[model samples]
Target: MLSPAGDDILIIMERLGPVQKKILLLFHGIAAIGLSYNPRQQIWILKQIGREWNKINQQALNRAIKSLYESKLIDIKESIDGATKITITQSGKTKSIEFKIDEMNIKKPKI
Candidate 1:
């Protein structure tokens, strides 16, 4: 797991469906955000991202999370508070960076 101090994500994007990609990105973002602060509190990145998604396709979010866990790109650890804890693996961060760079490199339409 890349701590809040790290910065990067990549190819995992290619293997993921759009929903999965979105979920992964959200985790990456949250992890980055939390690292800058000293407070150590559990944050549920998966559910937070899932809630931001379209309500009509909620099943898709669930499936995406299941896939991510199965692939070992992210972990959902048990918490004493009974809350979910999501963390992106190093592989996942590398893949997410790949996706972001690819997206940034896209040529814009000549309007």
Candidate 2:
């Protein structure tokens, strides 16, 4: 019973697989770019995801990070303060763009 846009997003998430989907969802959900700068400086603190996604545990998140890193979907860099920053990579950007396009197309009303 999902809308076309919702279905499109689901398809896109499926293409990215479970772990990447979680990471991407968390990133997009928080409207976050790069790393967070508060108390949990270097850590990948997806507090919302942690609370909302009951099926995903700390170990799952860790594996998702590793998969994203290895696949070049995301990059981890050390800041001047030695804080690790997570950045969406070029491929990730492209995929995001494609997802947006697909979603937009899905949202178009039928004539």
Candidate 3:
């Protein structure tokens, strides 16, 4: 059973486009792998995300990132090396919880 928090996240996610959802979930996955947003690792991280979204164009990715940034769901920083570091904000973390809730499979007991 989903708690109120889980329900709330789902409602929020419904308003986001597919690219935005994937980006949010991708950040969550990156964190799960213990990877920090290092300038040197930015390309690798983006490459991985690109592989998962082979059908998505670069322009779409950029637009989605821009929208997420404008929404304050993520923070983007530019490193001296010109690489952008993206971090999920607290609101983004709350939104990302929808991934876990969606993955849960609760079965009903047969009477």
Identify the candidate with maximal TM-score: 3
- Candidate 2 per-residue C-alpha lDDT over 3-41 given as tens digits, one digit per residue, 9 for 90 to 100: 775465445445576656656656554555244566463
Candidate 1 residues lying further than 4 Å off, grouped into runs, are 1-12, 35-56, 101-103, 108-111
Q: Write the per-residue lDDT of candidate 3 for residues 27-49, one digit (tens) a residue.
A: 88677556655665766766776
Better of 1 and 3 by TM-score: 3
Clash pairs of candidate 2? none
Model 2 residue 16 lDDT score: 72
Candidate 3 shows a clash count of 0
Which scores better on lDDT, 1 or 2?
Answer: 1
Which lDDT values do the candidates have, in the order given? 0.67, 0.63, 0.78
- What is the Cα-based TM-score of model 3? 0.64
At residue 73, what lDDT does model 1 achieve? 78
Candidate 3 deviant stretches above 4 angstroms? 1-12, 35-51, 100-111
Which segments of model 2 are wrong by more than 4 Å?
1-16, 32-55, 80-82, 96-111
lDDT (C-alpha) at residue 84 in model 1: 86
